[model samples]
Target: MTLDTDPGVAPQEEKLEMAADLTAAKEVAATDIPPELVAQSFGGYLRAWMARIRSGDSGVLPVLLGLIGITIVFEIISPNNVFLNTGNLVNLFQQSAVFMVLGMAEIFVLLLGEIDLSVGYVGAVGGAIAIQLVQPVTINLPWWLAIAFALVVCALIGAGMGFLITRLRLPSFVVTLAGYLIFNGVLLIILLLGPFSGYPTLCTSSCSGAQNNSHIIYQLMWGTIDPTVSWIGLAVIVALFGGSMWWRDSKRRRSGLVAPPPSLTFLKIALIAVIGVVLLLICNANRGRGVVQVVGVPWVIPIVLALLVVWMVLLERTRFGRYVYAVGGNPEAARRAGVNVNRVRTLAFALCSATAGIAGLLYAANQGGLSNNVNGGQLVLYAVAAAVIGGTSLFGGRGRALHGVLGGLVIGAIYNGLYLLGLAAQYQFIATGIVLLVAVTVDALSRRGAATGARA
Candidate 1:
């Protein structure tokens, strides 16, 4: 082409040659870049998790350890006793059900850096409404319809509170506290009037009313699926859990993303399987009173587990969940990012109330009926304590539904153990208060340590 004699042509040829060289160099550099490292074995994954814990992201480790310690202590104190008996264990599950659900309800709001003090009373109101509707002395509505009505009422109440808090810029604490009193009053009024009027005069060890144990409510609290059914259900659940974990890790690896080692994944599945089997064995044992044998997992156990799974998916897998974490982490930034912060918060409140309504149903079932004497104030406190104890941060933005389950178990164990040891009510209160204090202190220290580490 005689480029040396043509000035423009020579320049164009040189530029093209340079561009080709640069592209080749870039390709070489890209090839030289190292792949992201991930855990290649069980030991490596364990070390990674330990490192995370040391960095103040311990997750459920503390609570789990605490649970073990509590269990051991109780076992030692009640040597060769019913404290660890199958029947007692079943009772523990039933006792913890309401707390677990309520803690879950609290987590929705807590993760958003908000609190709903009224949830306990809200639950009472919901239960009362449902019970009345289904009672023969009242409208005698269908049990399903009664449940729907109660849940709807609770949701509306929650939405109203959310509106006031969001649109009116009211403090959640103050607003919810007010709601607590109002709802409690409403519950009392409901109990005192109409079908519930006869409830005041009747009293028993388990409940206050003769008509408390309606067919559906009684079944919910005391009924059990067949042992064969329980075993089958647990197996399916375990298989699903293992499969999901394996699939998630395999997908990540295929995408060239960080993934846990296959060995570690296997270990996780094994642990879950072990726990499930242990629980199943305990529940399947015959824990009889007199000649009557009680066996199989309580219906409430499956219900709580289902709720946990649903809430976990909602918080971890969805865009809305991300928005919740974002809003709690930094409201201003989230708003700037075009997230509808108010709407998220409002929805969180509504969800919290809905969960509380479910808890209320459980509570009523547990008691054989809804009563005016329901100590909602105490229950609310327990809910907060359970959530905090389970490793949810009081500061917000970092938590999971599993936290409630763990925390509720801790509370249940404590109460169950104390009862077995013949400890007084006052001791139970003191123990719970102390545990809550310790949890909060640990949470604060961990948060501070994390902040300092980040700076370092």
Candidate 2:
């Protein structure tokens, strides 16, 4: 039988043609898939995480909730102790303030996947200069003027470091290491000029515990507030936070973006209120024994909060923030996107130093004055640890300014709580080191999981 005359043979030819048409259709479909469509399908993995929470998976909430649970348990376990005291609680906020600011400063460099070792020493240098400027025998600048000058000088030093890193294309590790040593030397040099020869002391030698005689900067920072005023301050803070949240959420809704479910927003606000009330109650309870009654929120607390908001916005809101994240994630890509990577990196370094300077000044104020032996090296380690422990990635590209608060509070709590329990500072340091190591390890694992998900 001839093939054209055979019905079975004709049907086979038609079947082959149909198969070819199917294959062609598939090819067209594959080509028609837009790159953005492909990306969106894959990038659902990168969602902001609240989705998972709304679905009831614990995610990071467990870690935070666990910390709170532990705190409550310990509070109950040590009922008579000052752990629950309002004064100590407020002091904890004050104590952690500088660390939080320093950590934020560190965040800028960290987001670029760099480290700034000079921050501690630089802070000391800046604070010392500020103190010198305000001393009686010197320029005797007003406290405000002296502070501004000190911060500016610190910024210039940072800017200088940035210039070196960007212009010279030097490794930040080596550059900042050199800065650390040079600034430490500058601190000593600035300090040796001493008590401003004609300025009698601000207080008696006994009051200052300085044979050299010093000003009561610490007293000035914390001693002036009335005990009852802390509650008012706390109320104001709560009100502001509530107002800001409402405004932001309203903005998001108006923009036609996915607003967090109102339930989620209310939960967040409630959490803040709970924490705030607890803090205020503690502060109120811890006001006085009989003699050295201390009270009111420290000036440092508000300063730290303001800086946190600023840094948070810079990292999370602006185009600059997006660039920072991009540079940290893939510098080559950022460069292709027209970012001046070197300039950004340098600025990050400078900002870090300036922040460290602020922290240093606050540290001095916290102690009431500068001391030659103030463990700058140790403090730097704590800052780094705090940044990491609060969930920042050592590998970079995966953290936020708010993490610094988490990390700072954790660090401060460990130190203050341990001290209250009579543990030596050495043990606290050792514990911090262990916590930092664990945090880094966890972050590494998380990155691995994220990468695996991306590939999948």
Best by TM-score: 1
Give lDDT tens digits, candidate 2, residues 1-456: 000100011122345556767777767455532333111221232232433333332223433553475467546654477676676677777788777777777878888887788888898887787777766555666666777788888888988888887799888778888988898888878877865432222332345233221354444345434546766776787788877876786687567554554445555677777876665565555466688765555566657767888887888789888888899999999999899987777677767777887887777777666767767787777778777766677676766777677678777777777777778988788877776787777667666655543343
Compose the digit string of candidate 1's lDDT tens values, residues 1-456: 000000011122345556767777767444632332245555655656666667677778788889999988998897576778888989999999999999999999899889999999998888888877767665667777888999999998998899999999999999999999999999988777674563522112354343443556655667788999988988898899889878987897687666666666677788878888998899999988889888988889888989998998899889998998898889999999999999999989998898999999888878877666789999999999999999888888988888888888988898989988899889899999998998888788889877865555
Instruction: Tell me, by lDDT, which candidate is best.
Output: 1
lDDT of 1 at 77: 92
**Colliding pairs, model 2:** 86-282, 86-283, 218-368
In the predicted model 1, the residue pairs found to clash are none
CA lDDT of every candidate: 0.81, 0.67
**Over 4 Å off in model 2, which ranges?**
1-66, 69-80, 196-220, 223-241, 291-293
Residue-level lDDT for 439 in candidate 2: 73
